[model samples]
Target: MGGPPGPFSVPLRLSPKVLLIDPVRMLPSLLVPLVGVLVVGGFSPRSYLWAAFGLVGTVVFALIRWATFTYEIAGDRVEIKRSLISRSIRTIPLERVRGVDVSTPPMHRLLGLAVLKIDTGASGGDGEATLDGVTVGEAERLKPLLLRRARTEATPTARPEEERHAEGVPSERVIFAVPRRWLLYGPLSGAYLLTPFALAGGAVGLAFQWGDDLGFGRNAAWSVGEWLWQRPSLLVAAMVLLIVAMPIAGGVMYAVFNWDFRLKRRDGYLVAERGLINRRSVSLESRRVRGYEIVDGLAERWAGVVRAWAIVTGLGDSETRGQLLPVVPRADATAVTGDAIGPYQAELRPHPPIARNRRLFRAVFPWLVPAALAGLLLLLTGLTVWWVLLVVSLVMAALGVPLGLDRYRSLGHGYDGDRVAVRSGSLRRSTAVVERRAVVGWRLHQTWFQRRAGVLTLTVGAGAGKGGYSAIDVSEAQGRDFPAEVTPEWLAPFLNPPPGPHTPSDPPSTG
Candidate 1:
């Protein structure tokens, strides 16, 4: 019989095309040095020669890297070995694998290549590794091989589904797909709305830096300002156009990033596929999914749109990885959450009315301080601008009442069957649900004001997404009993025994 196998028995190499891809990936690192050379050496032949040398060096380094890197599925573990001088080997047990992400950037897609990322679901992201350049077929092949053992082990009872999925057949079914109209929620998400502005600011900053380097920054800035001052109507038109473009730009980016978004489910995994320029597909093991979180940004709530994500264990850091449903109508989000996790329709229990008072007081107090400060400043300096500031601060304080009411309305917690749900927040309202079994601990927090108000905050701790979800400002009674009701095994024993019959004990008489 042949000897068992060598250390690199079935070693696999990345696509040779990595020679081109790797160098391009390293080009960003060469920028600063190249720019420095150009700045110091000017556009002379010497600078060009130095730039060429750098490019050659980058290409050579890429070649060495490509030659050294090799990965393989050896036994029950996936092994990756790389580095030219100091060889390093990384081994991941098949059983610990929780997810696999495959992404194809525009360049990779053009070259028919993909990048495979292994997610071992380590809380610290220590076991995660990315294979940057692989043929599309190889990525697909490796994905299944790496995750197959994990899926089988996770769901030993799911024999039929596992068998079908293992054969590379179409065993998966679509749970939800984002409609194009739903893209309207993109602007309401509030993230994309500022993205264009942020990019513009960054570009402007870079332009100013370059202008300064070339010695015309101040003059250019002054000229632009003077020109804008000269043509006030033109400036106004430009401002209007910019305001109009923000939402449009946000919508476009959202669509491009999430075009044709689809959530599908196989036997033991939830598969999410999306992206336009950079197509991405991630497979998350269903067994580790604890529950669901529904988020409503302030604008999204006003628009009646929301987003949902699976609360999964060991997901770690990347919010996109747990996305169960992107921005959509509240009804659609509810359905997706129900389908992703188990269905629950229990009405959330509201907190005491005192809690509402607390919310309102807390909300307005911030603006009150500023308004008071501005009023004091105005009185002391008699400045018109300070008066205007005082007026604005008062108006903001007035606005806080409605915000406080909304936040109060958002605060609720309830339990149905074995699941507990808590909703809170104003700026980014979120409703988080977790199975009773998933409750790792319960924490009670009461500030001096809250204690005087007979209310406390109860935080539910779990091992999954975000780790802790709080039911802010509940009655002291609810704080004591709610946790015990949800997680009797852990909290019930710790509960204070019901007060013994109103005992009237004699007080000490000694001085």
Candidate 2:
């Protein structure tokens, strides 16, 4: 496939399997026409002809796209050429290649096909270009050559023999994979809890939108509401059915999304690839990964499970930013973090360097806004049922207080010669770790309350992962002394000069 890789040029068409993948991806676009045909079929037989025409149009389009798309690696750039109406050539320099993400969906895997997405930190478009369907073998060969500089040892004394493959055995290690038992957590992770409410609300909204067309007059809405109000048993059954259906749907989604999920440590980057139907692979260069965000929600924490995400720039969009590791035991997550970044203590030790009670109050106080609003509503309209809602809101605020307190308790900052760490959140706890070397700048911020309380947030700025991590509500002295302690010489000019003039030997002068 493409002349044995290694910077050779050859025109390659997308795998024929794309004919299968494209139609499914285009389902949403095809639905409007499909619905139109169904509506017209009620009046005439011409609808069948229209449906056949649409089907032919979609398949021909996907075919034309597959035929036109071709790419080659020649010189220092990987070039992609494609066209349906207008032809265009997009060239990405090898050195500018930040990452090459390759994914294999279930269908793709069966076909031995994969998608190659090239992200060059392009300002627009999630990625520069994607070769939607390509041979897995070709992708493997090209991956090493494209990322050769990145994967190789930086030392000048590095040997030719060290090239993981200039000979072809990629040093890919499995970082993690989803365990079968964790499937239960999948429903909990997704929309299962809220699915019933969302589905019910959506049904009501849609019914209102198309009621007249469906021969349900405007008065039909109020009539249905009255019927539901009169029949508590029927409403409960419907709710129970929705609730029961939600978990099943959530479980299905979970299985589909996390099927064969794997995180692989490969030449110079970490690749997270998963999915059953529409698989995705995201590659994060080690250098661009300034830090890692460890996520553990209340339930996951209770279950002793934790997940981590790569905190990298440019992949800020939630969909593209790949999770660094899968849902594994909390202990395992820690061990992996230590292995990948370095030994992080707040993770190992946990629950230290807590924010003061005032900070805890500040955190918990904001959650009461919903309860307050509910009370106001109850006062204006003395509905008996609203009392139940107000009670629930207050109960939630009560539950949230401890969670908020726990979040404040989770606030911690530490450094151990190589890395600086910050931990925050309780309901959804996160610990960010950045190498001391990756830090580009330091900033200390103090609000009026913080000033009065003698505390400030110490912000550590780096090139990766949203650019900054703050040590929330840290003591003033800690904030002032942190930069000097961590990156000593770099921030000395902006901060106090390392106490040179004020050294103990020269401290005799009161002036």
lDDT of each: 0.83, 0.71
Query: What TM-score, computed on C-alpha atoms, does each candidate reach?
Result: 0.89, 0.80
* Candidate 2 lDDT, 343-374, residue by residue in tens: 66533223323355665566556657767877
Clashing residue pairs in all predictions, respectively, total 0, 1
| RMSD in Å for model 2 | 5.1
Which TM-score value belongs to model 2?
A: 0.80
Model 2, position 401, has a per-residue lDDT of 66
Which candidate wins on TM-score? Answer: 1
Kindly report which residue pairs in candidate 1 clash with one another: none
